[model samples]
Target: MTQQSLSKFEEHLQDILQYRVEKELLIIKNYPRIIADYDRDLIIELMESLLNNVYCFAEKTITITITLQEKLLIIYVKDDGPGFSKKELLTATEPYYFQNKNSHFGLGLTIVEALTQKHVGNLKIVNSIDGGAIVSAVFAIKVENLH
Candidate 1:
């Protein structure tokens, strides 16, 4: 590869690494505040992604949990503010899908799903039992999967 190509690749990798590290720090910093004794980094990161983007996320109601089995892993993040409409949830993850001042804006949950799939997982938006929006994921278990 040319020097320019190498420089671009390095920059891309560095951005990804920095993003991951910043997300990890979010989990570690908020652990005690959210849950008592469980370590759900994936779920935490999902919530953080939403909360970080929305200034009023904490003020709004939120809940998260993890469900796991010997062979499966599930992370759920939920919010009780204005939940997404079906059409909204359906396309919210597509990066800047509904942008523009006159259009509805959303965080890239579609991108989030793609990231989940990289871990051999999937993402879905569902209605919470109580009320609100829920982001559920089903992932696989692997030693190296733990970042």
Candidate 2:
């Protein structure tokens, strides 16, 4: 893994965000030039999944934060929308488990969760205290590889 600029990730996410016409989505990136051994493809997949989920349900805006801890890369995708029910939150990442059986095919979070695990990472879905859904992905990183 090589160190790379996260601007590329932001660009990719913006492209995905632009697809939603109804919601006034806002992506706030509070990040430095995050240099680390990160999997670009997996990260893109994560962002795409989060963006799509938000666009489908979000009412006003979506805020994203990407930050790095000592040896962890954390990405937070938050939306000001009605959050998941307790039952939905529990099985959200499970493959083919959709809250509304008549609505979606239910593969987005499953793929995101799979890719995250493949990269030795974990995904958390919770409702923010401020009122919204927050999907956080924490990836293990090797800081020594940063340039």
Candidate 3:
């Protein structure tokens, strides 16, 4: 590759990182509003799992944080992998549906689904093609709202 091409690639990488940071901020900012009627620990655990697993994917640069406002508990996990197709995101809740062939019985997402439902919100898997997985769960403010 020529020097010019390499420079362009690096510039592109920087732009992508900047974009992910901005997106993460937006999601986290809305946390308090979303969790206005749910549980906190459930949200925390899900966020932790999401980040740990996404970071396991070499292409992903993930961040997990909780910012409470008003009466919501917002947990967002954003990564920098090829993201997921519409189908993969929607089907993540399905039993035994693994995206990559060898993911330990395909229960990662299933657990995500269970926990998400426990929080009374959705567990979403969004595709970040400039490579990542963005998962966020919004729960209400009450501890009793979770299992």
Query: Which of the numbered candidates is closest to the native, going by highest lDDT?
Result: 2
Clashes (N, CA, C under 3 Å) per candidate: 2, 0, 19
TM-score for candidate 1, residues paired by index: 0.55
Worst ten in a row by lDDT for model 3: 1-10
Which stretches in model 3 have alpha-carbon errors above 4 Å?
Answer: 1-41, 58-60, 142-147
Rank list by lDDT: 2, 3, 1
Q: Candidate 3 local accuracy as lDDT?
A: 0.53
Better candidate by lDDT, 1 or 3:
3
The residue-level lDDT of candidate 2 at 29 comes to: 64
Best by TM-score: 2
Tell me the tens digit of each residue's lDDT in model 3 across 1-147.
111211232233344445444233222232211212333346445654554456555352455545544444455667665677778777876778777776655666677768877867666667655566777665554422221
Q: How well is each residue in 1-147 modelled by candidate 1, as lDDT tens digits?
A: 011211232233335335543232221111111111222344345545544433233234445455545445565666665666677666767777653477545555755677577657778877666666777767664322221
In the range 1-147, model 2's lDDT, one tens digit per residue, is 556666777788778767776777666666556556777777888778767766776778778787877777788878888888899789999888877857797888888888788889999999988887888988897654434
Query: Candidate 1: global Cα-lDDT?
Result: 0.49
Least accurate 10 contiguous residues by lDDT in model 1: 27-36
